[model samples]
Target chain A: MQLVTPGIGLLFWMTITFSIVLFLLSKFAWKPILNSIKEREDSINGALSAAEDARKAMDALKSDNQKLLNEARAERDRMLKEASEMKDQIIAKATKDAKEVGDKLITSAKDAIEKEKLNAINELKTQVAVLSVDMAEKILRKKMEDRTQQEAFVNDNLKSITLN
Target chain B: MFSNKYKITKYLIPAFLVVLYVTYAGLKLANAQHEVHTDSTAIVTGTETGATTHSEVSHEESATEHKPEKVDAGKLIMEHIGDSYDWHIVTIGHTHVSIPLPLIIKDDKGLHVFLSNKFHHGHEAYEGYELKEGKLINLSGADFLDLSITKNVFAMFVAVIVLLIIMLSIAGSYKSNALKAPKGIQAFVEPLIIFIRDEVAKPSIGKQYNRFMPFLLTIFFFIFINNIFGLIPLFPGGANVTGNIAVTMVLAAFTFVITMINGNKNYWSHIFMPPGVPGWLLPLMIPIEIIGVLNKPIVLTIRLFANITAGHIIILGFFSLIFIFAEMNTGLGFGVSAFSVAFTTFMSFLELLVAFLQAYVFTLLSAIYFGSAVEEHHHEEHH
Candidate 1:
């Protein structure tokens, strides 16, 4: 019976103490503790999201750098190709001009050689005729008796000329 | 399967009979002891020597009550569990060493205040009042209000003060630290506070959990600290603060009152005219719903009180075994002491777990009630 029974004094005191504890703790202890905990939690969440935003921004910046590098590489390749094409054009033009100049020099040299050969040939023919006439006069003086041979040679030449 | 069933019943029948016989014997002993106490108090007026001589005559089995000083295990166990006017410490021979608490009373004469030690452990009467069966009574047949600080109340005050100091200091730390990382005791208690918020209050009370956090936290720590303190077998701890029916009654009443005050329109409607019920069954269903509403607090009170009281009883019973056997033979007493000590230690450790579990259950159930009371009628939108 005593085990199950509740004393009125204890009950009275319990209610008073419990109510006081609740009221005091709610006012002093729980309010401050819970508010600070909540504030800390919100701040923690804010920091985490801020870090996430920073990481995303960094990723965007890295990609932008990659795109710029790619564009610069493409520009460099295009410039190298243009330079090589211009060098090829300049080399082709020089080779064609050199060939034309060489051809003109060869033609002029051939014409000059032809003129010199013609002049030498005419002079040799006139000198050979004069030497032959001198040899024949010396032989005629030595041999007045050969006048008949000389007159026969001239008559053969005059006959050939009249026919022509 | 039939064979197996028969085999189980072969052992079960005898086990049930043994349990029945033991309970019958216990009840008879308790009845006999109860009569002995009343007879002594009535005739001899609550004296130590008078009660002993009277008990010896009543109980014939204890032929040598005077020489050996018979140990009444039942009485000892009862005394350990029951409320008292003073804080009992120990017993040496006929002398009881205890701390006397204050007694405040209001009678037809006037308000009287004095220390409970003036009664001398119920061995004598003081002034016009007398300590009868661990209770104070007015000898002149006058009614009075007993507003004294009993053993349980003193324990409660101690528990309350300790809770205040620890909690207020922790709250102060929170103010100083602000958003910085927790350290020392702050780090230790922060997780438990968070667990109550996140696991208990949040899930049990939902979005409005913040509105009830203060109440939830107060009750949770109050019950938990008292439960743990009740397990300590020393000064300021041994009193069953949470186990006391009066204390639990008060706690449960708080939950009940809070629920009633906060009950939304949907809650009241569900009680008066429950949804999904046929009009024909309205009369039957409403009464049942109302019963269910009142039943929640009763269940909370009984659950905490019974669990803590039963734990104390079992531990005390195991300890009593040693003395009960010692009355028979010294060697047997020594032999049983080993096992008794071992079992008591094991039960005490188990009680530690029960201590935390009961507190958690009380708080969780309270939060659930609060949650249901404030719950909105979201079912309408689902259709």
Candidate 2:
């Protein structure tokens, strides 16, 4: 019977003790404990979202760098092509100028050689006429040592001239 | 994992053998006790029905003759589980060593306060109140209120103090390390708090669980701590605080009051009108609902009280077996004691599990009741 009985004294004490426990714990213990838990959860979420944003920003920056590199490469390729074209054009112009100068030199040298050849031919003709006259004079003086032979020679030449 | 299972079975085989051995020994002892118990029951029944004429004459005469040898197992079990004014520690020969507690009573004459030790172990009367069969009886047949610090109440004070210290420290740690990873006792206690929150409070009571968390946690740790302390079997441990019917009644009352106070309009309507039921059935349903409402808290009270008390009785019963057999013969007593001690140890372990389990069950059921009380009706009929 005692085992099943509910003692009034115990019930009274239990009510008082349990009420105090509930009141104190609710004010001091549960309030701080639960608040800290919620705060920790919020911080964790903030850190995760921040990490996600950083990763996205890195991806965007990586794409931007790739675009800049591609543009630089294209510019380099155009500059290289223009430099090669200019080199080819300069080489062709130099070669053509050199050929024209060589042709002018050859023509001028050919003209000087023709003028010298004509001058030399005129001089040679004049010298050959002077020598023929001196030779004729010398042959006449030698024939006049005999006066009669000289007179007959002159008359024969005159007669041949009158007949012509 | 397979290796681990095999290892577990390796250890399990020996433990299983031990259990089998203990059970066999227990059955043998039971058979022996049963034989002696029949004769004793006849004498005990005779004493119980002294007013009746039939078998009392013969049995009463036999009971008086056999009183020296007979062991009262029922009395021993009751004394252990029942509340007392003094804390019994040990017994040596003819002397009982115990810690006397305070006794306060208010009678017709005036208030009387004294130490329980003045009773001289219930052999004498002190201050007009005689300690009779573990109860204080007024000498002049006057009505008085006993507000003594009985064993259960003292144990509750100890339990409350321990609860306060541990809980306050945990709260302090939370304040110092807010939003930081838990450390020390915080690490150990945090998970249990979260488990009650997620598994018990949230699922059972839903969103309004926050409002009830303080009360829920207080009762959970209060009962759990007291239950654990009750298992200690020493000073500060042996008081069956949670097993006391009065204590459990108060705890259940708290839940009942909370539920009634928090019950919403929908809760009341469902009990009074009971949606989806035919109008003719209203008469039967409403009374049933009212009975069901009252039954919930009563069930909670009995469930906790019975579990804790039953555990104490089983342990005490196994312990009482040695004395029961000893009263028969010395050698039989020695032989029975080995099995008695072994079974008592096993029961103690089982009680430890029961201690936590009962606390959890009480809290969970309370949360479920709260959930039902505050639940909203989203499917109301247009009519």
lDDT of 1 at B272: 88
Residue pairs with clashing backbones, model 1: none
Fnat for each predicted structure, in order: 0.86, 0.85
| Candidate 2 backbone overlaps, count | 0
**lDDT tens digits, residue span B1-383, model 1:** 99996886687657655644664454445445655667544454444444354434544445444344577888887777778889999878668899999999988888889999999878788869999878688899888988998888998999999999999998999999899998888897788789889999999888999988888888999999999899999989988888888899999999999999999998899898787777999999989998999999899989999999999989889888877765543334555666677678779989999998998899999999999999988777322
Per-residue lDDT for B88-146 in model 2, tens only?
Answer: 99988568999999998988878888999999999999888899989889999988898
lDDT of 2 at A22: 90
Judged by DockQ cut-offs, the docking class of candidate 1 is: medium
For model 1 the local lDDT of residue B57 reads 53
Off by over 4 Å in 2: A63-164, B1-70, B329-331
Cα lDDT tens digits for candidate 1, A1-164? 76667788888988889999999999999999889999999999999999999999999999888989988998899898888888888888888888788778777777777777777777777777777778877786665567787688788778888964
Best by DockQ: 2
Model 2: per-residue lDDT, tens digit, A1-164?
67778998888888988899999988988888878877888899998889999999998898888888988898999889999888888888888888888888888888888878777777777777777777777776777779788789888888889964
DockQ of each: 0.57, 0.58
Model 2, residue B327: C-alpha shift (Å): 3.7
